[model samples]
Target: MKTESSAELTLRGTKTESRVELTLRGLVLGVVLTVVFTAANVYFGLKAGLTFSTSIPAVVISMAMLRWLGNTSAQENNIVQTVASTAGTLSSIIFVLPGFIMIGWWSGFPYWQSVAICATGGILGVMYSIPLRRALVTDSDLPYPEGTACAEVIKVGSGDVADKDSVESSGKGLKAVLVGSLVSALFLVMVQARLFLGDVAHSFRL
Candidate 1:
């Protein structure tokens, strides 16, 4: 019996989110990552049938770049990561479009047909995921390792992991990231020069 009219309801003292939460710098960073990731992924996938995950990389890069912006917030970096991750997660159309040509199903690029197919597939995927997410994610205990790891990265970058030790740990975290990047870069360069193999696949009869 405590129902109140619409006019009586109020969020009287709620704090408003910062305007910097979705600033132009965040959008620009997201756009840059999106284009770079999409192009690199498409090329690498077609060439080697392998594509790197963008979610954590986008989050890490956004945090690093946004560190120079005094006004940047965790929400802004989340937006950037989400936008860039779309390139890696939502570009499944690439898998089929190229296959059509390779399989001789299409002699050449059919622009309109490709567009329609991609649009339909994307829409269906979105709609289907709504229910599947609830079932497999919301109601279930299935461990989503990538999502969990990304959240840990976000917390560490935002200093949400610790109040007292944040400053000290942050420097250590940056050092670890730099060392990992350097090692990865050197390994990739050697792989490209054929001094090492990126992967090895072996098969034998059972």
Candidate 2:
């Protein structure tokens, strides 16, 4: 029975050509894009003294280009955008929130303690999702839009499709890389060496 079931599974998976291929491509591109997007966000975060939220935007733009080139499906684009956006928001919260305690923008919590709790919550979220995978993907007819998009991305990468029209702007990724690096470096320097500000003191009363 088990062997028969395994064979059935293999047969089912083989029937989907584009979906599997695209998903693999998406995963590969997703990793590369995540790094690039995170760096850009961090850089802009420092420069503007606020979070830039680049992850979603970057993914959307990249996927939109892919779709325009007929390399990705609408569902695939949606998935990448959702994942990227969530990552961007999470990254911003993780990176910036703890600093609030050190600077006294918030009170009644230790910075390290809050950081630990936040980190734990992030981990738990991932853990919680594992049990639901079957429910989300296998148990019902709910479409896995993000999963489908990832598959499409994989397919495109594996197929080695060329962008013949070259509609995408050149040097955009390079600009993001350069700016992000410079800003993050400067922010680190200032934070570590205390170049700009001292231990600011404050007292607030209601």
lDDT of each: 0.70, 0.53
Off by over 4 Å in 2: 1-22, 64-71, 94-119, 126-206
3-97 in candidate 2: lDDT tens per residue? 22222232233223454234655565566666666666666665565665544344445554555456554345444554565446555754656
Question: Candidate 1: what lDDT?
Answer: 0.70
Over 41-152, each residue of candidate 1 has an lDDT whose tens digit, in order, gives 8877877777778878887777766775665565676778777987785565677787888988999888999989977886897899898765665556556677666656
| Model 2 lDDT on a 0 to 1 scale | 0.53
Residue 93, candidate 2: how far off, in angstroms? Answer: 3.8
- In model 1, how large is the Cα lDDT of residue 74? 59
- Which residue ranges in model 1 land beyond 4 Å of their true spot? 1-24, 162-206
Candidate 1: residue pairs that collide:
none
